[model samples]
Every structure is written in structure tokens, then in C-alpha cells.
Target chain A: MLLQIIVNGILKGGLYALMALGMSLIWGVMDIINIAHGAFIMLGAYCTYWLFNLWGVDPFISLFLSIIFMFIIGYGIQRYLINLVIRATIFITLILAFGIEIFINNLALVMWTADVRKVQVPYGASNFSIGCVTIPYVRLGAFFIALVIALVFYFVLNKTRTGRSIRATAQDLDAARLVGVDVAKTYALTFGMGVGAAGAAGTLWAVLFPINPMMGGILTLKSFVVVIIGGLGTMFGPIIGGLTLGVAEALGSNWFGTTYENFISFTILVLVLIFLPKGILGKSE
Target chain B: MAQRGATTKKLILGILIIAGIAIPFFSGNFIIRFFTNTLMFAVLASAWNIIGGYTGYASFGNVVFLGIGAYVSAVLMEKGGVPFWLAFPASGFGAAIFAVLIGLPVLRLKGHYFAIATLGVAEAMKALVDNLEITEGNSGIYLPMMNLSVKAQYIFFYFMMMGVLTLTLVVTYIMLKKKLGYGLIAIREDEEAANSLGVNATLFKVTSFALSGFFSGLAGSLYAFQQGFIKPESVFDVGVTVKMIVMAVFGGIGSLLGPLLGALSIEVISEILTNYFLVAHTLFFGAIVILAIVFTPKGIMDIISGRKKFGINYLLQNIRDHRV
Candidate 1:
């Protein structure tokens, strides 16, 4: 029973890790909390839902389309709106992002009518059992995609020229500028990539769970919990954090009832924030 | 010139105070209820200003105090057979103690960490309240309604909320002029420097948090009694915190009159928008927030105080200062 629970947790954790990746990038690079991170994810899920329902495209095929569309929107938001208050107090940026979230959420509500949506793929219900453990094909597929995206994200951050420029700017804005890196463009690109990751995660999320405009709020809080537990700036941090939270929440719900699920997550978050400010794998600043 | 300006300021203040006291008597029930609701928000925003604006700790969990206060007062009145007058003060005290207990450890963290930690606390508290048997396990609790006429009830709550607002403003005025307020401001400017200058950062931060909690609790207690019902969803709602913070920011953070002005204007504006646009009001509100932050980051107080001129050049300068 425990093994099956753990497996379920691991599957869920993979997606949670992917969800936190975009938020972590934005936080580490721009020093903004990106309160609108989950809004972008909701937007991505809607994009995938529309593509599937309208054109009958498979979610897997439309994932790339969602990413591209979200990237452009993300890029524009940062370049035009967020950049205007990028240099203000941290709370200013926080509030600004919050405004963006409110705007996006209300817009979604107006357009989508607060309807819960799901992606009904052909193999959504197909599951295989290995001994006593059952694994849904859709969940397994989502997990695999999450892993691939995380790997690709890690590679891009470490190996590419644009990645190098992004790192340089994150490290020292003036130095990066002096080195001929266009700081504004680099910031916008970083934000775009972060939003793209959110879009990809949202697509996978729609496959596994129901999607709605209000879903983003809890997800944003959960992503923050994952990020804090996983540590900031490290590639593997969110993965580790996500898995831990997933397993812990599963165990907590099992023991204390499902009503305590949020209670458990938030309690863990506070304890972690107090005791392990840097996270489990984070380095001392 | 300075003497004349001070005299005029005092004259305006006196007139506003008199008008505030006389408002409920002259206004109808609808207007009285509207202003009372406005007063409640003003108190909330003013409470938030004590910690978030003056002390520079942007707590995202101030609603926790509101929830705690509501529960406390509800339990005291309904379960303990306490009167509203006694239950109200007890609620404030209860929230203050909770603030101090949680603030000690939580205030150690800085910036976004503090905000997020507070957010977690509020969520955790809501969950706790949801599961607790005393809170009726999310079915919520009801307070004893006062045996009064409808007009009398309206006037009673209005005066109650107005009195609380007056107390908040007066306390804020005195605190800002005293050493404790200076210590808080010093901490806001630079905590490390304040600590080095012999200011106890932890004590001051916790104290400011407690003060903020105390007033928020009072507001919540009144809110519970006025509504005659309490629920985890209603009192602990994150939306309440957002409204208070936005009002504080919209008026001007760190200023005495900023939150008051912000709360009054925003509440009125939102009410108008709700009446006219209905569904699309929030969308417009979101846009207003975005435009306000982008254009007037310092808030309306700066413009009113003439510290920042409201013009094209000023707006352009603000953008230039912060834009990438």
C-alpha cells in the first residue's frame, strides 16, 4: 500500500516540479515573485483546451503551440508592463504581478465563464498494473514529458549562448550590459521561457485534472511551497522539493483526512520557511 | 506661510471630524450602511498600514487576525455567553497575542520570505479553523443579534466602526510622533542599521505586528456581529487581505492619511463600478491597479502632498527611474 502511494506521489511530484520551474526562474533572475505565474499556466491550459476542442488536435501535439503562444504573451507582458516597475521595491513588483493576475483571471472568467475543462484524450483512462501498483498511461506520459522538459530547461540554462547571457544578467546587470548583452531583451527572453514552461505544465495538468480559472490560485501557492522547499536557483531543487511535498501531502491526507491536505502543506511550508530558509539543497548565501 | 498652511490643515481636519460624527444622523439607512462598510475597510487598511507601510513588513496574512478575531468573538458570545462589548475587546486581545506568538519567529525572515510566510500562516489558520470542532467544523458560528430596531442597529454598528477608526487614527498619530514609531520607521529604512543603533528589531517588529493585528481583529469582531454569522470562507478570505493592501498602496504606504484616503476612495469607486458594470468591474479594477502602479507607484498621497507633481514629466520620470 505504501509503495503504491509513493508511486502515485512521485507521478504527481513530477508535474509539480515542472510547475515550479517557471516560477523559480523568474524569481531567481528578475527577483520578482511573479504572482501571475499560475495565471500564465491557466492561460496555457485554456489554449490547449481550445486547440483540442476546436481543431480536434491531440494535447501532446498542441503542447508546443501553447508554449509558443504563452511565450509571446509572457514576453510582451514583461517588456511592456513589468519592466516599468522592475526596479521598484520588491512589494511594488509583487503588487504589479498581482494586478496582472487579477486582470488575467477576470479576463479568463469573462471569456470562459468559469467552466471546468478537461482534455479527453483516447488513452486517458488506460492504466497498467505492475504487481499491486496501478499506473495510468496519461499520468505516466505527463511524468515523462515533465522530465524531458526539465532536462531541456537545464541544458538550455547551462549550455546555450542565450542561457549564458541570462546567467550573466542575473548575476550582474551592469556587467552584463557592459559585456554587450541587451539586458531588456535578455530579461524578456527569460520571462518568456519561464512562461513557456508554465504553458507546458498547464497542458499536462489539463490531461490529468480538471482546469478552471480559479485553479491557478491554489497552484500558485503550491508552486511557491515547492520552490521554497526545493531551494532557489538550483536545477534539481524544484524536482526534489516537488517530490517531497507530493509524498508528504499524500501521507498527510491519508492519515488526517483530505480536509487537512491544505493544512498539512501550509504547515510544512511555515516550518520549512522558519527552520530551513535556504531549503534542503540550497547553499548558504 | 507655514503658519497659515498649518492653520488651514487643522481647520480642514476639524471640519472632517465633525462631519464624520454627524454623518449617520443625517444619512438614510442605505447611505449609513455604505459609509459603515467604508469605515470598516478604512480601519482595516489603517491597521495594515501600521505594519506594512510604516514598518516595511508587507504581510500577506493580515486576514489571519481578522479570522481569529471573528472566531474568538463568536465563541465568546455564543459559547461563553459573553456580551458583545466584552467579547469585542477580548477578540482584539486574542488576535494580538497570536500575532506576537507567530510574529516572533516569522519576523526573523525578510522581504518576500516574510510575505510568503505570513500567507502560509493565514492559509494554515484557515485550515485549522476548518477542522476544529470549536469552529463548528466549517459549518460556521453565529453571534447573538442585538435586540434593537433596524435603524438603531445600523447606527450602532456605524458608530462602533467609526469609533474604531478614530482610535486607529489617533493611535497612529501618537505612535508616529513617539519613539516607538521612530524605531519602527528606522527599522523600515534599514533593519540592520536600526539594530546597530540599539533598536530591538524583533520586539519592535512584533509589537507593530501585534498592533496591526489588534485593530484588524476589532474590525473582524464587528464584522462578525454585524453579519450575525461567521464562516471560515468569509473571515479568512485572502480577498480581504488583498483589498486592504491595495487600499494602503493606493493611498500611499508609510503615510498616516494614505490608507484612510485609499480605502475610502477605492471602496467608493468599487461600489460604483459594481453597480454600473457588474461583471466587468473587477477587470476594470485590475486595469486600474496596473495603471496606478505603473504611473503612480508612490500613490495619491504624494500627489496630494505636492511632493510629486501630477504631470507628464513626473510620470515619465517615474517610468525612466524604474524601467529596464
Candidate 2:
């Protein structure tokens, strides 16, 4: 039972980490809460769904094209629209993000009409048994891809100049600008990068779960929980937070029934907020 | 003299009150419903402003109060068999009581922490109501709306709404004149300084949150009873609470009249737009949100008061202030 739970948690944690990675990147670098993040994820899911249904593209291969598509969309949006009120208070950012969420959701509604869409691969039901526990192929594939993305993210953030610029911007915007950094382009790039991460997560989610316009809100909240739990702004935060929450949720559901599963992340968020806001792995020094 | 300020306030109040009393008789039922929704929102915005505007504490998750009020009143009347007259107030109080109780712990966190905690609570409420069997989970229990007349319920709620709005406005006005309201404004402007000045910061903030929670809960109950059914999606909606905050900000955040005006104007504008062009309604709202923030950061109230006149030059000034 424990092994099965661990397997289930790791798979779910992969997607959570994928979603939270974008959130962490954007939030850590740009200091923008990016409330419309979930919508971007939703958009990614749709792109994959249609690409699969229409063009017979597998979810994994479709990810590259979806990432590019969402990247451009996110870049255009941030540069043209979000940058307009980037100077306002945190409250205004919150409001504008909400407005964007509404607009995106409505746009999705117009296109897809709120139908729950999914990527129906031939191997959705296929799995392998190891010892006494069974593991699903899709879940395993997702977990593998998640590890790849995490490693790539670690490489880019640490080894690359643009990634360093993003990190510098997150740490101190004025200092980065003083050193002749083009903060606007960096901000846009970071946002696009965030959206690209969502696209990756979306493809994975579309295969494992279903898609809808409303999925963004919960995903956003979950991302926050993951980021908060794993400690904010750290590249590896999502991996730790996601695994902890996924496993905790699994245990909670198994014991408290599926109904209580919904409250698990929220409860963790509140407890973290109240008791240890910096999170378990939060850096004090 | 304070007399002059009082008189100006009184005259404005007189005109608004007179208009409110006369509007129902003058308008058709459709118009009445629209105004009823606008006024109800006004009450909500006013309630939200007490916490968000005065205290600088943004609550992105207040919709559950309405849901609770709705469900409490709804379940009681629908299942426990209470009458509307008894049910609605009970529902409102149910939320109010919960707010005070929860506010005890959650309100201790400062700034964004409080906001995030409130959001967590709202999300939890959504999960709870959707999952709990006693609330019938997601199936949604039907209120006994067929037995009552819609217009009649509308009028009763309108009056009730007016009464609540008046109460909120009056209380806010009185508090603004006293140390408590002054302390709240000071806190919003600069909490550190306010604390230095010996303001009972914690007491006043908690009080304001409870007050805001109470009226919003009342409004929520009324909203539910009028709608004839309750659902978790609508009740625990972050969007609705955020809309109230926007309305308050758009009209003016710190003033009594700002929230009322913001709610009415935004709702009316969105309704008209949606009525004419349903597809572009959200687009228009989004545009307004962006424009309102970019241009009138202090809200339309300030624009009307000549604090910052809206024009090309004002736009330039805003860019100067906000551009990174």
C-alpha cells in the first residue's frame, strides 16, 4: 500500500512540479504573481488536445510546438499588456491578472465551449507490475519527462547568462538594471519561460487527467502550495513541495476518503502560512 | 468648520437617499433587478473597502461568506424548515459569527499573508461545501422560491440592502471621524508609523475585518435567497470577491461613496456591454480593469475630486510614476 502510494505521489508530483516550476520562475524573477498562470496551463492543454485529435501528434512530441506557441503568446501578452501596469501596487497586479484570467477563460469558452477535453492515447490503460505493485506507463512517462525538465531547468538557470539575468532580476530589479540589463526584455523572456513550463505540464496533464477552462484556478493554488511548501524562489522548490503534497494528499484521500482530498493542499497552505510561512525548507540565513 | 464638511456630506447623502427611494417606483422590473444587483454589490464593495481600502489588506477570497449565508439560510429554510423572514438574518449572522471566530487566528498575519490566508479559507470553504454531504454536496438544494413572488423578494432585499449600505456608510463615516477609523487609514497609509503613533492597530484591524465580514455575509444571504438556489462555485468564488475589490478600487478605495459608485458604474457598464455584445463583455471588463489601474490608480473618485484629472497629461504622469 505504501509503495503504491509512493508511486502515485511521485507521478502526481511530477505534474505539480512542472506547473510550479513556471510559477516559481516567474515569481522569483519578475516578482509578478502571474495569477493568469493557470490559464496559460489550460491553453497548453487545449493546444495538445487539438493537436492530438486533429494531427495525430503524440502528447510528448506536441509539447515542443505547444511550448513555442504559448511562449510567443505569453511574450506578446507580457510585453504589450502586462507591462503597462507593472508599476502599480500588488493589488492592481492582482486585479489585472484576474481580468486577464477572465478574458482568457471566456476566449477558451468561445473556442472550446467548456467541454472537458482529453488526450486519449492507446496506452492510457497499459501498465506494468513490479513485485506486488502496478505502475502505469503514462505516469512513468510523465515522471521521466518531469525529471528531464527539472534537470534542464537547473542547467539553464545556473549555467546560462539569460537565466542568470532572470535570477538577478528576481533578486533585485534596480541592481540588474543598473548593470545595463534590459529589464523589460528579461521580464518578457521570463514570463514566456514560465508559460512554456505550463505548456509542458499541460501536455502531461492532458494525458493523465482531463482539460477544461476552469482547471487553471486550482492549478494556480496548487502551484502556490507547492512553491510555498518547497520554499519560495528556489529552482528545486517545486520538486520537494510537489512530492510532499502529492504523497500527503494520497494518504489523506486513502484515509479520509476522496472528498477530504480537496482540502489537503489548502490545509497545508494555511498551516504553513500560520506556523512556518517560510516553508519547511525555507532559508533563514 | 466641521459644520461645512458635515453639511456637504449631508447634502450628498440626502440626494443619494432620495434617489434610492424613488428609483424603484420609477424603473421597470428589469431595471429594478439591475439596480438591485448594483446596490447589493455596492454593499459588498463597501464591506470589502472597510478591510481592503482602509486597512490595506486585500481579501481575494470573501465569496464564501455569501455562500455560507446562502447555504445557511438556504439549508435552514429548505431542509430545516425555517421561514424566509427568520432564515435570511440567521444566514447573515452565521457568516458574521464565523468571520469573527476565524478572524481571531487568520487576521494576525500581516499584509499579503492575511490575504493569502483568507484565500485559503475561501478555497477550503469551496471544498467543504462541495464535498460535505449535509449541504447535499454538489447537487445543490433548491430554495422554496416558487412560493414567493420574485419582485416582492427583490423589493424586500432592496430595502434590506439599502439599510445595510446605510449602516455601513454611517458606521464608516462615524469611525472615520473617530480614532478607530483614523487608525485604519493610518495603517493603510503606513502601518509602521501608525503603530509608532500608539494606535491600537491589531484591535481596529480585526474589528474592521469582522464588520466587513458581517455585512458581506448579510449581502450573501440576501443574494442566495433572491437567486433561489445555492452552489459552491458561485458562493466560494474568488472572482466575485475580487470583483468587489475592483469595484471598490475603481470608485475610490478609502472613501464611503467610492465603493458605492464603483460598484454601480462597473456593474452597469459591464451589464450594458454584455447585453449588447456578450462575447466582448469580459474583454471590455478586462480593458476597464487595466485602464482603471494604469490611469486612475487612486480610483475614479479621485478623478472626480480633481485630485488627478484624467487626460493625456495624466496618462503621461502615470507612466512616469509607474514605468520601470
- Model 1 misses residue A114 by how many Å? 1.8
After the best TM-score superposition of candidate 1, give how far the Cα of residue A31 lies from its true spot, in angstroms. 0.8
- Distance (Å) between predicted and true CA of A190, model 2? 1.4
Q: How do all models score by TM-score?
A: 0.98, 0.94
- The segments of candidate 2 whose C-alpha lies over 4 angstroms from its true place after superposition are B1-15, B78-89, B144-150
- Candidate that would win on lDDT: 1
Task: Provide the global lDDT of candidate 1 against the true structure.
Answer: 0.90
Whole-model Cα lDDT of every candidate shown, in order: 0.90, 0.82
Worst 10 residues of 2 chain B by lDDT: B1-10
What are the per-residue Cα lDDT tens digits for candidate 2 across B1-324? 445555655676688789899888777778778888888889889989988888888877777677788888878888888888788778767887888777777877765567778888888888888888888887776787746476676677678778878887898888889988889999889888999999988787888887888788878777877788778887788888888988998988888899998998899899988998876678678777877877776777666565444688987786567666
- Provide the TM-score of chain A alone for each candidate, in the order shown: 0.98, 0.97
- Per-prediction DockQ scores? 0.86, 0.57
Task: Give the Å shift of residue B57 in candidate 1.
Answer: 1.0
**Can you give the lDDT of residue A225 in candidate 2?**
84
Q: Could you tell me which residue pairs clash in candidate 2?
A: none
Over A137-240, each residue of candidate 1 has an lDDT whose tens digit, in order, gives 88899888888988998999999999999999999999999999999998999999999999998999988899998788888899999999998988888899
* C-alpha lDDT of residue B65 in model 1: 93
